[model samples]
Target: MGNRQSVVREAARFAEWVLREVGRELRVARLIAGMTQGQVAGVLGTSISHVSRVEHGLIKGAGLVALSRHAAVVGLKPWIKLYPIVGRPLDRAQLALFAKFRDRIAGTWRVTLEAPMPIPGDLRAADALLAMPGCQCMVEIITRLADFQAQVRMAHRKQRDIGASRLILVVAGNDTNRRAVRDAGAAVRDAFPLDTRATLAALTSGVDPGADGLVLL
Candidate 1:
């Protein structure tokens, strides 16, 4: 009973912390824009009481999407980042692969980890970001092709804001993943052209891949 009580306390604290942080950001934005609570409420199509409740953290279960709409009216863009609390083992392996990729390509392009993306709940983290003389590329390291379509769609949305000249997916050389990609058919192929040889050559020759594609590294 004591342990359960402690866990409940911890959860409540976390919730309060999140609410405070979000409320603070909203307050700051409103102040910066020189907007009154009533004005913000008007824009949001809500009553002044509702806006006050939100600012005071009295509102419960208000999603980021609703907040974002309110923010947009006040010249603010609210972005919330959502990620797994504990990464899977496959994710750890991908990080190692990302390191290898960086080591091999660092001479030619500047590499960064966990790049920013415009989309909410889809942080610009495709393992690594490679910026070169003329173009930038997002590199994704894949060990499995589970939910391949969703992954591609998310990457596509990320590219809209990332301004990546090329999108590269490096699949761990495995039969299962290869077959999965093959089964994805035209959708995957259209998104990522296969240029295994070009990708490998570019890493050595200090040139970017000729086009966006998949490379078995």
Candidate 2:
């Protein structure tokens, strides 16, 4: 309940910030176009006070149609862009890459796809879990690696929570991911000591790589 409330509060704050920014831009455009609040309101068939409130971002329920009308009156264009939400559902490419990794490791070890975390009520799950005679490995597969540090921290947290003996980060062997790993350099090395070759060798041989590994699929 607390977590949900916190998320709602954060979202409200972000929406307020965006509204203020948009209002500021509209105010500037109106000024540059030599239009008064009254003039804009007249064109939009609304009152000057309503226009003032909208421009000041004081009207929390200002609709897009009203905003667009105001922008049109001020010789400005209103547009919105959508971005992928953090931890969004996997796309086709990502799912395919996961399948490839699963096939590679399934031959040698017991592989569980989308294995739940050990902690009760924790919705998060490891992308894959690999088990051998004396080892349990938690795996995170990335089709396109972004925010390297955040990914590392998440992997570590999952490993600790699940009490896995080993952790492996499997990424698609594309040039983009390769470059990302290269740019990360020492940080990547420090987190996952085993490189592609060594990691694969250990996985195939059912041996604990002795440390966390970064494997390219």
Candidate 3:
């Protein structure tokens, strides 16, 4: 219910932004065509106040027909474009690195890719989940690290919500990612106490790491 309400609110905000931009464009078109609001109202068979309201994006609720007419009078065409929501695209290098990591641990741990969060109605999912006798780990794989703090917070949330015994961030061993981890320094170390070597050893041995970890892939 909360997620649905948030989506509705976001949609409303985006609609409001689009309406305001369209209104501005319409006003600009009228000015470019050397026409007055009264002239536009006359052409559209509407009142000057209605035209003014539309131009200001103050009119609301089922006004598409009126808006279309107004747009035509102002010598503007209105259309809609749709796009799919998608995650960040990984490059070939990242894909190859991820595959190698998967193969390395495939023999020891039970790995689930794109593991859904345990909470019902939650759309978010972990990059991977690894399980064995003593530990259940929620893992996030980052080929390119941006906004380190935000990523840490998101990982923490997933770990808590999924009730995993440990959280592991598998970062690509590129210079950029390495520098980012180095710059983060103590914060990274504190959040993920176990080092890459320790984390890998634990996973290979099917033992509990006993804490959160950051592994360089």
Best by lDDT: 2
lDDT of each: 0.71, 0.81, 0.78
Off by over 4 Å in 3: 1-94
Show pairs that collide, candidate 2. Answer: none
Residue lDDT tens for model 1, 1-217: 8866875776566566676667777788889999999999887889998877777776777777887887686777876554421112236878877766666564767777767554542323545678878878887778777888887776666666667888888777679887887788897768777566667667657677767877765
Among these predictions, the greatest TM-score belongs to 1
In the range 64-128, model 2's lDDT, one tens digit per residue, is: 88788788888888887442222244578878987877666537788877777775435467877
Give the Å shift of residue 168 in candidate 1.
0.7
Better of 1 and 2 by TM-score: 1
TM-score for all models, in order of appearance:
0.61, 0.57, 0.57
Q: Candidate 3 — worst ten consecutive residues by lDDT sum?
A: 81-90
Model 1: how far is 72 from its true place, Å?
A: 16
Q: Please identify model 1 stretches exceeding 4 Å from their true place.
A: 1-48, 55-90, 99-106, 118-124
Q: 1-217 in candidate 3: lDDT tens per residue?
A: 8876877776676667667777888999999999999999888777889777777777755267767877888788788644211122345765676676776564778887767767643546777788987678998888889978888988888788777889988899889999999999999988999988888887776778898988897
Listing every candidate in turn, what is its Cα RMSD in Å to the true structure after a full C-alpha superposition?
6.9, 12.4, 13.0
- TM-score comparison, 1 vs 3, better candidate: 1
